[model samples]
Target chain A: DARVTQTPRHKVTEMGQEVTMRCQPILGHNTVFWYRQTMMQGLELLAYFRNRAPLDDSGMPKDRFSAEMPDATLATLKIQPSEPRDSAVYFCASGPPADTQYFGPGTRLTVL
Target chain B: EDQVTQSPEALRLQEGESSSLNCSYTVSGLRGLFWYRQDPGKGPEFLFTLYSAGEEKEKERLKATLTKKESFLHITAPKPEDSATYLCAVQANNQGGKLIFGQGTELSVKP
Candidate 1:
């Protein structure tokens, strides 16, 4: 069965290093979203894209974080000079529309 | 601000026992309410979606019902496989698919 797929199910990086997470949305899904979950913050929406154009990213940190969809099949979330506070579970989700989202096995990032 | 809140941050139940978890929200308009089950290290698995008040949906031992301001996830005679963190989210029509998630209720079913 087709499902949203994310790479590097786990990641460990030194603080200040550049880290990138990748996601492949389910085939034919038009909307993709990026979310971060932590023990302190619960789940927070970082960004969302529709048909490859970002619709809302107000939840994202503009200074050190960036999200993009290079093409229909791929979406990426990157952090420059990552910090210890950035250590959290980053989830990638997709849906045909806005109501329901299908999440992928999240990428757990540990910044040391 | 639009928000979702779930109650009973955690719950423990014996196998074959039944219980209900709650999700309350404050949003300008409601598009849908969603229920998901998440394992410790995995992504959330979709369970049900309720679109309106008095609407109910079920699968296996899990049933979800929605009302004007809240939703409930009812587990009936649950099994070990039913142990998980149950999450509730709300979608608003103007929110463009953005979901407000509640603090999940961690459920444990022990035999």
Candidate 2:
């Protein structure tokens, strides 16, 4: 079965640390999306890429957060100077031309 | 501003009970409405997608119907394994593959 895979399923870091999360999309998918989920905000889209090029990152904190799809298979989301408020589960989803997306298990991050 | 809202933040049902979850949305132009099931400590899984008003889709024990302003996910004879948070999202015609999600309705089924 084709599924998205994420590395570093759990991460705990102190404030001002850098955290990087990686995702591997299913083969043959062209679109990738990044999302953050928390109890208060629910789920929010952070960024997305189509064909390895970013489509939007408006929801991400530009100064501290960055998302990039270096190639077709690998996508990464990085946070610099992380804060306790940034603690949340980050999810990566991939899809074909259709809008329906398949999500990965997600990376749970905790900042102290 | 485009927004999506789900009612009854949580729901509890007996093993054989049937119930429905509501998702209301307001957007400039509707493209599609999506339903996802999220388990504790896991990512949301795709359930169904409704394209327009009067559209309906079904899978196993769940049925989803969409109208102009809202959508409903109807569960029939839910099992304990069916317990999860049901999320509703909408894609606007103006946005390319971007989805606006609701807070979600947590469903608990007891055997």
TM-score of chain A of each: 0.98, 0.98
Which runs of model 2 end up more than 4 angstroms from their true locations?
none
Task: Give the poorly placed runs of model 1, Cα more than 4 Å off.
Answer: none
lDDT of 1 by residue, B57-91 (tens): 98988889988989999999999888899999988
Interface RMSD of each: 0.9, 1.1
Q: Per-residue lDDT for B33-57 in model 2, tens only?
A: 9999999999999999999899999
Residue A82 in model 1: lDDT: 97
Best by DockQ: 1
Candidate 2 local lDDT, residue B6: 100
What clash pairs does model 1 have?
A: none
